[model samples]
Target: MSGALARLLGRAALHAGWIVVVLAAAILGGVCIGETAIPPATVLQTLANRLFGAGYPLDRIDAGIVWNYRLTRAIVAACCGAGLAVAGVILQALLRNALADPYLLGISAGASTGAVLVTVAGVGAGAISLSSGAFAGALAAFLLVALLARASGGGTGARGTGQIVLAGIAGSQLFNALTAFIITRSASAEQARGIMFWLLGNLSGARWDSVLSAVPVALAVTLVCLWHARALDAFTFGADSATALGVPVRRVQALLILCASLATAVMVSIVGSIGFVGLVVPHAARFIVGVRHVRLVPAAALMGAIFLIAADVISRIAVQGQVLPIGVVTALVGAPVFALILLRARPAR
Candidate 1:
């Protein structure tokens, strides 16, 4: 017993340290490693000068690049990664599937559909924002899947994974098709090209406003998930077992799902559907911290932030002069890892 406790404490300490390391790495990658590569001392001096009015030597263009573009992209990437990973953690628990993610579950697709409508069709021009439209669409998609699963007698009983997966597949396809149709009909050739880039997860537009809008919601929802860690653990043993333990299974499930979906929609609205952070990060965190949500959630959040920030850096530098879509980078990295995971999951014959 004492040995197990010691191991757990050690893992907890590692998780805490990992958070600091990743956060520092994010800053370094954002400020010192991008195009025109600023020096660490210069980056620190620039920040110090801004905060403390200290005279630090730096060129205006370099300072502008770091402060206005790279740093903002880094911050937004971190928020996006953390938010999506938390959503992944919740959906995996909610649906009882290791592979469940916002994009896989169609939530991101729904958000994309809504954003495309706002941008292309001008659905709510002058009145509604893209973020609001995406949030509504995300909720709609989740509700549609839940209702379909429930109708098919899936969410509450028997190998519910099949039902949720099937429902999600159907809903995702429908929304994605709708998004494509909207783009085709409403967008001009140039507008269609821009929309396609956005849908593929462009972070070139990352700014302070996007970070301000996303981080608070991401932080709040992630904390709420961590607080409910025990309840989520109850879910691992199935709904019947959870009920026997006095957990209001349906209510808690609904609340967490809504929170996760909302965060996902907001992030997707801003960044345009970066996939696999949610799916991949939690699993990686689980390998390090086990399945306890308290440690798992924060670890996954930090790991995700690191993953996306690193990916953003790579996206910018991969092709000499042009930046690639973040979604493309993550998909390239995640697909093989995910496949290997599945191959390992194949039961011994």
Candidate 2:
């Protein structure tokens, strides 16, 4: 037993170390490869100076841009990616649907509606922050969906799964229509453009405050999911099977779904509704790590962080002078990849 434990610890450490190296490299690239083009060495030196007081005589402007703008944006991007991906994994597992994602519960659409209410409709009279409004909207949407599911005869079986998905669709459409109506009636052209950009995911405004909000939510959600990893694995075979295996089906579902919703709400509130990370990353992680929840969870998070950072970088450099909406870039890539996954999933005729 002692020898087995030692080997397991060693293997775990190796995996952790590898993940750190890869994530660090991705963050560094995100910091260095921008419109201003700071070198990798300068990026490292700036980090050393700010984080450790190494003080390697760097230009003030460059350091400010690296430390303030790019680094913060990269970290927030990572948090968004990880949170969304883990949420996706949880939903796909609990719902037992390959197509399930963070937004499947109408959270993103609700968040967009809430943000529009704050920014375009002036619902708060300038008192509430956009993020706060978005979060509120997400919670409202989820509550409505949950109630709708219950009315539709919620169960822990296939029937329950279908009901939840349908309810989510209805909730999403309602909130989306509300958003459109508000924008059409209340927003001027300029305000509409800005709101639209944010709705499609703009990380340009990411800063230290965004980082502080995002990091904690991401960590908390990930830890909660990991804590319930065994329960999640039991869920893969359906709620009845999980219950038979001594798992509290309804309780686990409620807890993990709430965790997914909270994580999704916080991320959407911070960076707007960036899609496909929650959808595509889990599928990719499943391909790489198989179906085990323990390995699949962290793999999805790591791949998600790298994938979104890369997408963000592409969004910045895709056009000569203009940054494309990160959502557009994600859709452009994710749609085709998902299509291929669907084709592969089809059995031989």
Candidate 3:
């Protein structure tokens, strides 16, 4: 027993070390590869100076861009990716649908509408911040979807799942239409252009403030999901089966779904509606780590973080002297994968 326990501890430590190394490498890559092309050695020097006071003399401008701009953006991107991917895993587990994701509940659409209201419709009369408006809109959309689901007799069953999905679709459409209407009626060309860019997922505005807001939410959501990992595993066999296995079906579902909603809301509010990280990364993680939630959750989070950082890097370099929307890059990659997954999942004739 002692030898087995030691082996387990050693293995766990190894995995943790690997995760840290991979995450650090991805972050450094994100910081180093940009239009300005900061060298990796300088990037390390800047980090050593700021983090440890190593007194490495680096270019002031390079240090400022690395410490203040790229590092913050990379960290926020990682947080958004991890949070969204975890939310996707939770939703997919609860709903027993491979297609379920963070945005399946209309959270993203609602956030967009809220942002448009603040920026275009003047809903808050210039008092409310964009992120605040987006968060409120997300919550409102979720509440409306919940009400609609309940009205349609949704619960923990196949029929319930269908009803909830339909309700989400309805809610998303309603919010999306409202956003389009507001943009068409109220926004000037410049405001319209800016809103469109943001709606398509721009990480250019990410700063330390964004990192401060995102990191806690991502960590909290990941921890909560990990704590309830067993519940999620049971949920894979349906709520009825989970209940039979001594899981408090209703309480677990409510708690986890709420976690996913809040996490999604916070991320969308911070980064706009970047899709596919949630939908694609969870599936990829599941493929790599199998179905156990304990392994799946952390794997998903790690992969999601690295994936988003890479996508952001691609977005920065994809166009000559211009950045593509992060969403476009993700979509361009994810849509084809999504189609392949769907095709493979189709029942054999």
Candidate 4:
């Protein structure tokens, strides 16, 4: 038994190592192919100056582009993708449902609703901007679902996962309608543009301050999720069985929903709604490695980073000189890739 345990651990570690290497390569590849491909030597120098503050003398505009523009955007994209994917794995595990993702559960929609509301209604400025509003929106959605879940005739039964999903669907439709309404009612051109950009989702607006704002939320939420991996593993066999094995089922369920909400809200707030990374990356990670939550969570996060980074790079080059919204590129790439995967997985149909 000890030897078998060792073997399993060894296998998971190997997959994790490979995934890390692949993700690093993809990030570097993305840096290479974007709008202004800095010469490798200059790229190194620019990066060194930005990170270590010790590169050769650099031009002001070039330095600004490297330090102020590209690196932050790339990091934010990677962070957003990773957080969503981690949240995806948690949802999938909790519900014992393969199709579960953080956005699919309507958290992203709720966050988007909040951002649009702020843009339309005109909210606070500076530090109290979009991300806070989006977080509040996500919290609202989670509370609504929680309330509905416990109501009589709702999904409070043994498998409350279905109830949660139905609530998410309802939330998505309602918020989407609200978003369109705000867009239609917009008096100012900038308001409409803000709404549209939030829906389309991109990291082009990533600021160092905003990126810093997101990092701790993302990191704290991820740690909370990581701590609960064992509970998630127990969930695979169903809630009752997990409880039978002394897992605190209700507490874990609430924690998963809460932490995932925080992560999703912050991600959507900062980067808009880059879809399919959350949905696709976890499944890809699960396909390559096994579904053990320990490896699965980090693997999904890493793969998601790579997925978004690569997709954003493609968006840059997909059209000559025009930077398409990363969200659009993700859907365009994700839909066909996911379809092919599903087709391949189907039983020789």
Top of the candidates by TM-score: 2
Query: What do the candidate models score in CA lDDT, each in turn?
Result: 0.86, 0.88, 0.87, 0.76
lDDT of 3: 0.87
Instruction: Report per-prediction Cα RMSD to one decimal.
Output: 3.1, 2.1, 2.4, 3.4
Per-residue error for 132 in candidate 3, Å, reads: 4.2
Per-residue lDDT of model 3, residues 1-349, tens digit only: 9999999889978988998899899999999999879999999999899889999987899999999999999999999889889989998898887877757678788878887888789887899987778778877887898799999898867777788788988998999889888998999989889888888898998998889889998899998998999999999999878999999998988788777877777777777788888888888887789999988998999999998999999999888899999989889988888787778668999
Q: Model 2, residue 231: what's the lDDT?
A: 91
Q: Kindly list the per-residue Cα lDDT of model 2 for residues 1-349, writing each as its tens digit.
A: 9999999999989988998899999999999997879999999999899889997999999999999999999999998999999999998998887877867678788888888888788898999987788778877888898799999898766778888889988998899899989998999998888877888989998999999999998889888888898999998998778889999888888888777877887788778888888889999898889999989988998998998999999999989899998989989999999898888779998
Q: List ranges where model 1 is wrong by over 4 Å.
A: 1-18, 155-158
lDDT of 1 at 66: 75
* Per-residue error (Å), model 4, residue 79: 0.2
TM-scores for all candidates?
0.92, 0.93, 0.91, 0.86
Candidate 4's C-alpha runs over 4 A off are 1-24, 123-129, 146-163, 347-349
Write the residue-wise lDDT of candidate 1 on 1-349 in tens digits: 9999999989868867877786877767666887667888877777777779898878988777777887788888888999999999999987788878998888999999988878788897659898888998898888888788778888554457878878888889989999999999989999999889988998899888987998898889888998889888888778788899999988999889888888888998999988889998888888788998887889888888888988888888899989899999999998887787778668998
Model 3 quality (TM-score): 0.91
Which candidate, 3 or 4, has the higher TM-score? 3
- Please list the residue runs of candidate 2 whose C-alpha ends up more than 4 Å from where it truly belongs after superposition: 119-132, 149-159
